[model samples]
Target: MNYNTTEAFAQELDQKDPLKEFRNEFLFPKNQDGKPQLYLCGNSLGLQPQQTANYIQKELQDWANYGVNGHTEAEHAWMPYHEFLSESMAKIVGAKPHEVIVMNTLTVNLHLMMVSFYEPKGKRNKIIIEADAFPSDKYAVESQLKFHNIDPAEGLLLWKPRPGEYTCRTEDLEQLLETHKDEVALVMIGSTNYYTGQAFNLKAITKLGHKHGAKVGFDLAHGAGNIQPDLHNTNADFAVWCTYKYLNSGPGSLGGCFVHERHANSPKLKRFVGWWGHDKSTRFNMRKDFKPMPGAEGWQLSNPPILSMAAIRASLDVFERAGFDNLRQKSKQLTGYLAYLVEELNNPNIRIITPSHPDERGCQLSFQIKGANKSVFDALSKANVVADWREPDVIRIAPTPLYNSYTDVYTFIQRLKQVLA
Candidate 1:
């Protein structure tokens, strides 16, 4: 598709967008001038869905009317509330209902997954991760090494990109594994890199890890709701992601976990046990031994936070209506347009670090502006373009297909050109 620089061309595309109606469903932040700010920060935090307040209010009303009885009698039934999100959440990440669980925060779920999947034996005690993985993931892996009494310097292997390159190559990873041999215990990676917006090939990584007799898992903090990792078909041992980003749940909402069906009932897979994960039939009984529930449900440590789950339910409903496949299709086109416009700027100082191919990224385009400072980002903010800026020089803009129009992309580029000029 040829992209035009004209704002009229953008309006034409917006008029034809099938998902255009979704923009109305979100509540955007307004600039001081009283117009909606151009929000291109879905990779950081998605705009609130218009229905989120209603969803939370419903639960609040139920709590007030039913008191403690809301646990069983509310319309959504607090006791089984988390169960309501299973199907739609599963679809978003490309997993089966049973394999997905809405529980805990991103790092908490990472720790939980590591508890079960990061077992190290004999000489196979090292872990492999992306060199520039999200800090939390790196910290979590390092902490895991310490918990197991292994020195992180020796146990944590970094799969770094070549010195001058910006993205880690799969072949380099293969060679790293070959060098490490069977000494590596687990392979954990961010499905979509946060800084560079590079989406890794999950199936290939899983197969490579498994071939080395290691467990493979992904941190989908930037992948969920943006790029489909196909968790089930990727044959990953486990994956974890938060809902607050592209999932559009409120800030710090509950995260999601996906455990492949193969481990659904594996007795040997050790995990931290809790009452919520016990078999439902006897869960209320005080005396029964803990019988773990089948699948990802077995990993829940406690009953979910109703308000947070309510927000998630609200977002998932929107995703359900929009359909993940359709959203993904629009996302590719939407982000592709942003890339095209960025290239049209013809600014040698601005270099896109994100993968050029749409398949290798989500909506985010990370631009490394040579010798740029926060002032450049400040200019964008002053112009009412809400984007993300990492330390050093990268300015990250994400033209989300859900709420962002083609016009938003055009307008942002126009403002960007002014700043550069």
Candidate 2:
């Protein structure tokens, strides 16, 4: 695990990487000189897979040739297009195939899950979330509270870090639940926080929430294709994620939803009914009442968009071919090398806020840059380092396992060092 700053060492690592060829599978942004930039912004928006166009073109051709008849006549069959993605999506998130479905976008799916799981009877009406949850999640949870006529300030419980640190502790959530066990109705959290890149222990959180009589759900926006969250084993009531980030399914592609097998047939739980959620056999029978289809598919609000799904299909194909386990192996080493280079800098102004342990983070490394470091970040951008800048003083870099190479990581560190100098 020894890491060196030398380009040859990085080239050697890249040469040995089983997943290195995937770098060629993506279309990277170009620098003015027409070479690919050192892209580390996969945490924000992933580079498009090369096959995406072909996938979409196939669908477009089918539509042009057959129009409405393409629904059942196309090779992929538009009527059941979403089915093609379910199994692969399930594998990426570590869930049973029946428990996962490609459906609405992330926040939209979050709202749907809350409708079925965020039930408030009397005193048990509060929702607990990490203090640093993505802004969209915070908004969704707060709106869900308001929709239920509960005051958000009173109905929401924050599982915050003990002042100085950035990540939330599971014990802290347990303490909050203990203090208000009767009041908590739901536990909604982002499995890996967006800003800090700190991944949560989902199984622990789910168990605690269930023990305290609350339904648990995780927003896997930052965890989905980057880390194996094992939603089925975690026994969460529901989970949701977008395919755009690590899944590389293109901008604002369809999100995925997971409903635990336990809730698959829970007739007692009320849900907003839709035709697409009706049993397929009876779906076309016009007069039949809403008989919810048994698993996560029962949550679908509409027939999926096939073009967007083409992109998801293309990306999931890459995940399937590269293999999730292998991707995780490279991811650990890649991010570790980035961490090593940061520490080797030994600069007082630079610090990594993400948990040093691989289990506590994914591909992202959020740099906490101090005074006068904003210019360094700007320099990194101008030099085509392709990382993202968060407000105040953080520059987030993600060396994705599927496409980034050891060489990219090495050159990024070199560029950063030059900027700092």
Candidate 3:
């Protein structure tokens, strides 16, 4: 498809889009004049599904009518609520149903999974993470090391980008594993880096980590709804992600975790236990021994917040209806269009940090605008062209296929070009 820079071209593309109807499924943001604002920040927060309000309302109504009995009598049954979300989320992340569960926030889930998987011993106590990992992840790993009485400055190894390079190379990771052979206990990486939007090769990383006798985990916060990561196929020890971004479950919604089925029944798996993780059969009885449920459920520390889980259920239904494969197919085209527009700018000041190859990235494109400051971002925001500005000079834009259209990308580029002028 030849890229076009006109509104007519964008409209024509929309007319031919198979997923065009999905745009109506969401509630688009509006400007003061009541026109829908151009939303291109799905990488940070996705628009709400029209069904979301009704789903949440149902739970609220049930709670009002049934009181404590809502646990059993609610329409969706609050007692086993998170289970309803697990199967679909598992499908999205490419994990077995039992291997996944909706739980706490992203960073919290990462810490919990690390508790069970990051078992450091003797000389094999070092943990490897990306140099540019999301701030929360860095903090989580550092705190985990501190909890184990290890110095993070020495125990945490950072897989940095080569000097002047924006993305981390797999060969560097392989070399790090080889150099620190038998000394590293775990490798935790962001599947799609937040700053660069570079999607790592999960299968390769997991294979190399396991070969080195180390456990591997991934933070799929940016990758979950943007890319199809087959966690089971990757043979990753575990993975975690949030629902508030591309999943569009609402702000600060519950997150999810995945533990490969191979460890589903591992007796030696060290986890922090809670009643919700105990066998459901004896849960209400309150007298049975704690028998951890197999798979990801075994890691739950408490019953999930039902209100948040309801929102997740609402969003996952959208994914199920849209189908992840179809969304991904359109995503590549939408983001490719955005990249094409950026390249067409022909500005010496702008440099895209995201990988040029479609397979190596998601919907996000991180770019550095030369001679541009926070005021440039302020100008874009004032124009209602919603893109994010990370620290320093990078501006990240994500054109989500679920609700965003080609015209959104076209409009954003036009605004950017004007701002630059």
Candidate 4:
């Protein structure tokens, strides 16, 4: 496909967009003059779908009418509310319905998954992770290490990139696994790195980890609903993610977890148990012995939050309607257009840190604005371009194909050029 730096071309693309109607389905942030700002922040907090209120209102109504009986009598039936969302949620992450569950927040779910999978024995106590893993993940792994009385400085192995490169290479990971073949107990990676937006080959990572005799898991916080991590196909021991980001659920929405079917029925597997995870047949009887439910639902510890799930349902309804294939196709074109525009500037200082290969990244393209500071980010924000700024000279922009337009990409680049000038 031929590409050009023309506003008319951008508009033409928008006109031809099959998913154009989705733009109106979301409420965009407005500038002071009340126009929709060029929103590219979906990688952080996705825009609210207009139908979210209706979903919430229905639950609110059920609570008002049913009171204490709402658990069994609500329109969504609170007793099994989370189950209603399982099929669609599982589909989003590319896992079987039995393998995925909507539950606690991301970090909390990570800890839960680790409780069962991170079995350290003798010399195999060390954990391997990507160097630039999200801080929360690092903290969780470090805490897990400390919990087991292992010193993080000694027990945590970082799979770093080649000097000065922003993304980690899989060959480096393989080399690291080979070097520490006997020492590793777990290999926990952020499938799509939060900082660099690098999407790893999940199946490859899992295969490598298994070959080295280690449990492999992924923090799919960035990969879920962005790139298809294919959790089941990867045969990852476990995976976790938050819904608030690319899933377009409300702010700080509940997270999701996946445990491969192989471990789903392991009664011997240890976990932090709760009544919700007990056998539903005798849950209310409250017996002394904890009869664990089967599959991913076995990891859950509490009743579902219908309010949050309602919001998730609303966003997922739109996702189900639009379909990920269409969204991804639009996403590549959108991000590619932004990458092209950035290159058009011809400024040696403005270099894209994201991989040029389509499969290596999702929607985000991190720009290393050499010598420029956060002030450039501030100016961009003030110009109504909502992007993210990381410390030490990087401006992160994402063109979410769901609600963002080709025109948004063109206008953003024009504004960025003005800011650069």
Candidate 5:
């Protein structure tokens, strides 16, 4: 596909975009002059959907009208409010509905998954993760190691790139697994790296981990709604993600969890028990012993916040209308245009650290500014180009397909060129 640098070309592309109408469905942050800022930070936090307030209001109204009876009397009964999100959430991640559960936040779900999957015994105690994985994941894995009395210095293996490289290589991961051999008990990785924007091949990673007899999982915080991970086909034991990013749920919304159908009824697995996770028929039977729900729901520690789930439902409805495959197609082109324009800049000061191949990335493009300069990012912010800055010198831009336009990508480059000038 030919990409032109002209603003008119962007407008033409936007005019033809099937998903262009979605841009109006989101509420963009306004600058002082009352113009919508160029919001390319969906990789960090997505713009709120316009319908979110209404969704929350319905729940609030139900609570007001029914009070405690809202448990079953509400239109979207509070008792099963979380279930309303499962089918849509499952569709976004390519998992069976039963395999997906909308539950605790990302790190909490990560910890819960580790409890069941990260069974380190004897010498098979080491855990493998990317050296540049999200900090929360690193902390969770380290604490889990310490919980089992293993020092992180010896028990955690980092799959890092060769000297001076930005992304971790799958071959390097395989080599690390081979070197660690039976010493590794778990392989947990972010599906798409947050800082670098490099998306890992989940199935390949899962197979590699299983080959070494290690339980494999993924943190999909950066993948859900941005890329279809096909969690079931990946054959991973588990995966988790937050809804606030590409999913377009409001800030700090509930996260999602996926447990493979294979583990759906594995009674041998140990999990933290909760009333919500008990069998629905017997959940209210106060005297009955805990009987876990058959699938991913069994991991629920408690009922989720309805307000958060409402926001998620609002966003998922939009995804359902837009269709995931269509969004993926648009994302590849939207992000590709950003990459093309950045290359056209031919600026010595800025270089794309993210993988050039669309298959290897999502909507995000991470730019490495020379000499770790922070001033360039400051200028971008002052110009109202709402991108995010990472430490050392990377500025992350994500042109989300759901609401971001090609013109937004074009305008951002124009602003960035001026900043560099």
Candidate 6:
């Protein structure tokens, strides 16, 4: 599709967008001159919902009006606050409500899930992760290995892209599993790699891991809202994602978790649990024996942070109103438009590393600017284009369907063209 570099063309698309009204729902960033900046960095931190301030303010008022009683008397009721988010979040990830829970931060949830799913047994103690997994994930896995008194160098394996490629091939992953079938115990991959913007084949990975007698899990920090992941159909043992990115939840918001139903009722499964994971009926009794709640809620460690959950509530409400299917459809169109524009740049220096096939990605596009460095990013920032720079030479741009418009992508490409020239 050839996009016209004209305001009229962009305006026409905006007029036809079913989600055009959503752009007003967010508080867009502005330059020092007070002009709204073209924000294409939703892959990093999503724009704040217009209702977020009101949501946070409501919590403050509850604290003032009810104090300790706010747990039960608050407007939204803090006692079961996390439950309010579960249904919407479950919808976002394509999971049953009982199989999902919103709690803790991203790394914290990953570590917690590993406690139950990464259990290393007698000859099957090794774990496999993508070579370029997000730094936080790598650190969490390394620490978990050390916590278990295992040597990371010997027990952790990294699946890498081929010599000149930026994405991992399923064939390579299968080969590794076959070679290490006797030693591999678990496989944890980033559902969509942070830097490459490559969305992995979850169902295929899960099936192969299971065939090798290994459990499969995913860190979906870049995948959750950017792409629709059918966690239940994938049959993954577990998965975790942060809400701040594509979910549009505020900074440091609570992360989400999914535990496959097969393991939901595993009475023999060992986990590091707390009272929050115990049956609510007897939890207040403060008994010694812990009877875990079935499903994803069984993994909770403590009461969630209500203030953060409030921000999440505000965001998920936006998602619920807009509908995931609607957002996803627009996402494909918005991102496809961005890709179309970048390719038309016709700059031999610029090369998109993200897969060309739409099925292999979501909204993010990672590209390398030939012979350019961080100064290239500095130039874009000076022009009020808000894309992010990954180290070396890559810049990642994501046009979120909920808040971004066709004009934003059009203007961003114009600025990028100037910067490159």
RMSD, candidate 4, Å: 1.0
Write candidate 6's Cα lDDT for 1-421 as tens digits: 5576677888799999999999999998899999988899999999999999999899999999999999999989998888898899999998999999999888998988898888888879999999999999999999988988999998899999999988999999999999997889889999999998999999999999999999899999999988888999999999999999998888888899999999988987779898899988888998659988888998998998888998999999999999998998988888888898888888898899999877799999998978867787899999998999988789999999999999888888888888878
Flag the better candidate by lDDT, 4 or 5: 5
lDDT of 4 by residue, 164-221 (tens): 8999988999999999878899999999988888889999999999999999999999
Candidate 3, 259-371: lDDT as tens digits: 99999989998888889999888887898888988889988888878889888899999899889999999999999999999998899888999999999999999998777
Give the distance in Å from residue 13's predicted Cα in candidate 3 to where it truly belongs: 1.3
* Model 3 CA lDDT for position 282: 83
Residue 94's lDDT within candidate 3 is 93
Task: Provide backbone clash counts, one per model.
Answer: 0, 0, 0, 0, 0, 0
Evaluated at residue 74, the lDDT of candidate 2 is: 97
Locate the minimum summed-lDDT window of 10 residues in model 5.
Answer: 299-308
Residue 358's lDDT within candidate 5 is 93
Write model 2 residue lDDT over 99-189, tens digit each, in one string. Answer: 9999889999999999999999899999999987889999999999999899999999899998888778888888999999689999999
Question: What TM-scores do the predictions have?
Answer: 0.99, 0.98, 0.98, 0.98, 0.99, 0.97
- Residue pairs in steric clash, candidate 3? none
Which residue pairs of candidate 6 clash?
none
RMSD of 6: 1.2
Q: In lDDT terms, how accurate is model 3?
A: 0.92
Instruction: Give lDDT per model, in order.
Output: 0.94, 0.93, 0.92, 0.91, 0.94, 0.91
